[model samples]
Target: MSKEIRNDSECSKTDDKDWHQVTSIEQIEAAIKKEFSDESDSRKTVTAEVKNDKANWKIVLKKKNEKAEENFASEAKSLKDKIYHSRFMTTIRAQKAERFLAGAAVVLVLVVALVSVSVSTCYEVLVDGENVCYISSASELDAALKDLKAQADANTNADMTEAVLSTDVEVAAKHKVFVETASESELAEILQEKVSWQVPGAKIVVNNGESVLAFATLTDAQSVLDTLTQNAIAANSGAKVLDTRFYEDVTAEEGNVDAEDILTPEQALAQIAEGKEEVKTHTVVSGESLWSIASDNGTSVSTLNELNPGLREDRIQIGQEIKLNKIEPLINVVVDKVVTVSEAIPYGETVKESSKLMKGETQVVTKGVEGSKDVTYQISEYNGTTLEKVTLSEVVTKEPVNKVVNKGTATVATSSRSSSGSSSGVFSWPSKGTISSPYGKRGRGFHTGIDIANKKGTPVSAAAGGKVTSAGWSGGYGYCIIVDHGNGMKTRYAHLSKILVSVGDSVSRGEKIGEVGSTGNSTGPHLHFEVIVNGSTKNPINYLK
Candidate 1:
């Protein structure tokens, strides 16, 4: 047997008391496979050596060597297979482990980065060493600092400073509030910037965190406090707006400014006056006096009466002209000279040759001279009411002397009659009377017939022979007679006292037909005689034969 050597100390270390439990067979195999343990075990002897006779010994050695070789070869092959398999499995496990470790490391780094990015910092705002508000963003922190400084400069109270510093500030992902102090305006501005302002019809009606004044246009929405310093009305009232300054002096007098073209209260009132127009008219009513009508129409009674000259003030008729209330026109009276008279001079005769005079040729021997009567003019007085007469100059020329010439002819009241129903060629006055009113239109009515004033019971004679027709009371004619001469000629004597002829009675010229009397609506004793030819009344002066 080979010498078996072992360390007592090592053996004692492996005792039950020292090592109570074994980890695994793999652990034991590793320990036993160590170089030191393998060398020591290799040196251990097996006791009682095998026979070594020459042949027997050779055979035994050969057999043993063969078996040993077999065994060695098998053990080496098994060990080699185990080593290869185990090595491959171990390499795979190591690779998987490395991949897992790398992935875990990467996840840990991402987690650390994410945690760092989400973190924020806080800040406090100070106003003169006094805390105002807290913030968590850089931009907010800056704004807070500014607000705090302003508060300090202004010497604002704690409440006001705090109020000014409080803000709803927004933060970007990279930014955080770093201060506690922020003005209200600054905070509002920050919050406002985050929202979109491009919506249709959207009004950006806020400025510096304050609402802009509401108005139809910007020009109309200016702060009154800003204008108070310059506006006279505001100066008198002493008012301020938006915390603006107001310094008013009550001793200062109010100013007056005329705004004729402006759309203001006073201007509106003045416009009413400008739109007014003046008009005038006249109206006639019952029981209205001329004076009253004139007054109501803004005219004088005399002026109104002059337009209706026939009207009397005490005897006014309905539907008469009356003045109306209205504005009167400004009149400029101008007087101009006018000629109303004309004169003519006649040519008088003087012998131009003696032989012409011997022939007794009287050619207008007495050229009658013409004379002119004065034309009277009148000026109206009493608002052109009364007329004063003015006489125009009269013109006359001396009468020319006439030379006498004689021609022989028979003198008789009657001339020879012709075969045609002609007159004896003589004419005499039909009737004798004085004219009361001449032919024309008098005041208020037409004077259709002439008024011949005559004595009562005067003899009415026929101027020519004719047959008498029936006559009686007509509209305004009484005691009348109509005489029809044979040649479509007729005559009428109206308002007479008596009629001496009957119907179809023949009458001669110079025979009495009636007597003058006032009858049938006659105003006086007068004859209304008419001469009708071919069914028409002819003027008596034109046909008195």
Candidate 2:
């Protein structure tokens, strides 16, 4: 018998007696014999027929009243008709068609919901409305643009006050964009290649003029200015910052530099720390030569002689006002302070003859404690350096206990090479000179060491065998060296112009170690010598013999 079939058309099969047009013997046998149940109203029953005439097969999908499903069924049936007609094929199609229709209805609903949910399909990354590329999400495009801007700001070493790369996102249900996809890193590179970033910071101006320098912050520029003013004078004086201001102009510029690229405060101070060019006159004091006056006034001997052409550089008599050129401060920072401090009145030692002690042995019978004295001082400073300190009042607070020491009176084997015999203990004279100043009270301050005034280049020797503990420029002592004799004794050689030994070198007694000169605070060439026993300064005269 001949049979016909409808593709994607509804045909009811609710009852067992209900028949199909493809009920031929071969078609009936091709369908599976089973007890089928139709319980769902949403999923209707359908039949897929098999035609023996020329081996034609057709699938009829019976679906609910749904527009999208009907449209999909018509298109699917058209495709199947072209590929399956006149082909030898057989499939048990009743149960499959019912299940396929139910699944198709659910998928159709989901597709419709999805089409409404997103009017924009792919996230289209646009640069100035020109499509760059498409990303999966709008947030991904935003993240890429944000990363690009941050990197640009960091690369330029400044803040981006204005936007140079304009970026946005666009979405559409369908768009014909033919750009390649890029990752976040690649997107940053693409944006950077297309635009330049803006650099904006503060500029430091000096002396009421426009400055070309731009620092990271206003404080940075201000620091550079303040450093220049503070050191505008000589090494001993100071200056104050004045008329300082910050200039802030935010602009989009290229080829900008970082704040660290500019010179530091120390470097800026070195360039402008010399004060204004001026000459002054200073009256000559007793025992003052051109070199001595220049050293005291922060000038060179050549400058003093040049300022006064007729004045003799070799000899300048007292009461003669010599011309001196010294750098002064731009703004003086003078400090006048009154301070009260307790001074130590050192205990005097007493020596007693003892026969029990060996000839070269000694013993301390009593320990001494330092006495205190209250003193008031008036101090004056130029810049940060102290210029003068005057004692206003003094009062003794306690009387010190005298110390007693046993002395060895027996004759001991000893040798001396010094012409002036001051050595009586364990060392010899460090230099050949008269005692210009003793190790005692001198003027307002107690002298901690003895001063030996000699010629400009007198040789200074080590007082005893010891290792040099320190050797360098010392405060108020100029070029100095300290020798640790390893027996609770240390000797110091100060106010030398040149040092011949190093810090860790070993030397014997009377070994030449330096040359005498007025390098530190002194009126003439001299050697300041000190003897320390058990970390206390003692009379150097006792160690010289």
> lDDT tens string, model 1, 1-545?
11222322243222222122323224322322221122212212111111223212100111122323443444334333332234322453456543433322111000000012233344544434544444555576555446544544344211222222223333333222122344556554543332211111111122232322122122222332223223423322322211212221111111211111112223322332243345444556787888888777668877776556666787777776543433321111112222244444444445433222212122333444444443323322211222243445554544435443322121212222455745442222334688676545789975544556789888887655566886666767878888765455566778888878788877655678788888897889988766666666654444454
What value of lDDT does candidate 2 attain over all alpha carbons? 0.58
Across residues 1-545, which tens digit of lDDT does each residue of candidate 2 receive? 21212221143332223223324334332221111121112222233333322222333334333544644465446423532421222122432333333322211010111121222245666666776666656677567667766766655445555544333445332321122356777766766665444334455444333224555556555676555434332332322222221222312122444423344445434433454456578998787788888898888878887677888866678899887765653334444556678899999999898754434345679987779899887766654556678898999999899898886544312332235754555677899989999999988999998999999789999876667899999988889999887656778899899999998897766779999989878789999999887778887776666
Off by over 4 Å in 1: 1-430, 439-449
Estimate TM-scores for all models.
Answer: 0.22, 0.24
The C-alpha stretches of model 2 lying farther than 4 A from their native spots are 1-423
The lDDT of each candidate is 0.42, 0.58
**Candidate with best TM-score:** 2
